[model samples]
Target: MTTEITARDKLLLYVVGMFAFIFFFVQFMLIPALSASDQAAADLAVAQQAQIAMQDTIALSGTNAAAKTESWAALQQANASYYGLLSSSDLDTLVSNLELGHNLAPLSLEISSINTQSLTGYAASDKAEDTAAPGEIDSSDPTLATADTNAVLMELAPPLTRVYASADYFKACTVTFRCTGSDSDFYTMLDDLAGQYPSVQLRSVQIDHAAYTDASGTTTGTATFTVQLSVILCDKESVAS
Candidate 1:
């Protein structure tokens, strides 16, 4: 038998079915969709940050390139200036100019002997000379016997002087020189030589005469001053080597 449905019962069934549909939609579809949208927004933000970082790196690289170019230009200018000065002047002229500028005089100078000792090997000859009143060799009394002997000795020799002539790289050279002038002149000479000649050094300064007064004739004692100087030759190559 079929029972007739009442209006209230029908209304109650409709309300319950509507509630169940709403709950299923919220739990299974709407919440997951909202969560996926939020994750997408976070990923987009990270991508934007990476792009900004990349742009900053590119800008910094450009700045470094500009700085390097400026430094290169400055170095080129400095090298040009140095070369221009070097090309315009000779060694002797530069030295003389420096001396005059520093109020120094190039006094009497001399280069002493340069020597070198080396080991050399020699061979000995086993032939005896018969000096019988100019009769050098007698009739072969059984052919003369010859023997070879090796020997070594120390040889006192002169070094290559031209090698030391280079002003660029001077080797060891002993400069036995004399300078006679006032105290100021002497000191100025020292300064000038040290500044101009990179290979010149003051080894010893022998005071031949100091400031003394000759009072034999006049009552007022007037002093005559002089300085005797000797310099040694020092070269960059010698020091470096």
Candidate 2:
């Protein structure tokens, strides 16, 4: 006996075929496309980071160039203002200029000393002293130990020493002078001197006053001014050559 196909069987076969096609389409096309998209996003992120780093490096280089230019300009200005080594001829000129044109009491100019200390060694010694401990009292001498007394109070403070450059390259000449006169005249002389030599470095100033009391208890005084200054010295001929 032969069996006949039914409409229900045909419809069932079509539904199963449709489900298999849908499954294969998702596995072969949709899944692979999604994976490719994720990989492309990761690659884009890495490229963006690299670009940002390059931009930062370029900016930093520009900043450093600007700083170097500024430093060079400052060095040139300083060199132009500096005076060279002192000489006998220069000394004579300096004295003549001060005495002839200016009006004040009799003043004298003298060279106090020349300092040629190493900057590195001086700074190291200062650091060592700062880190050292205080010394104990001395039993042998009637007075306190020099170290103990010098450690803090009851000791005179040393003058501030400014280090400009290496001892091998430069020397400092200390010039000191005294000016005595009425207060008005004294200050006017100083102002004029400063105006003439604007680059001179004034180190210290000391003033002394002498007053006399008369029968009526009135007092009159004249002031004396001591001024110390520093002049930088170098071998200008050698440097120029």
Top candidate on lDDT is 2
**Best TM-score goes to which candidate?**
2
After superposition, the stretches of candidate 1 with alpha carbons farther than 4 Å from their true spots are 1-7, 56-63, 72-241
In each prediction, how many residue pairs overlap at the backbone (N, C-alpha, C within less than 3 A)? 0, 0
Q: Compared with the true structure, what per-residue lDDT tens digits does model 1 show for residues 50-121?
A: 999999989899897777567545534432322111211233344455445644455544443432211010
| Model 1 clash number | 0
lDDT of 2: 0.57
Candidate 2's C-alpha runs over 4 A off are 1-59, 117-170, 192-199, 206-224, 233-241
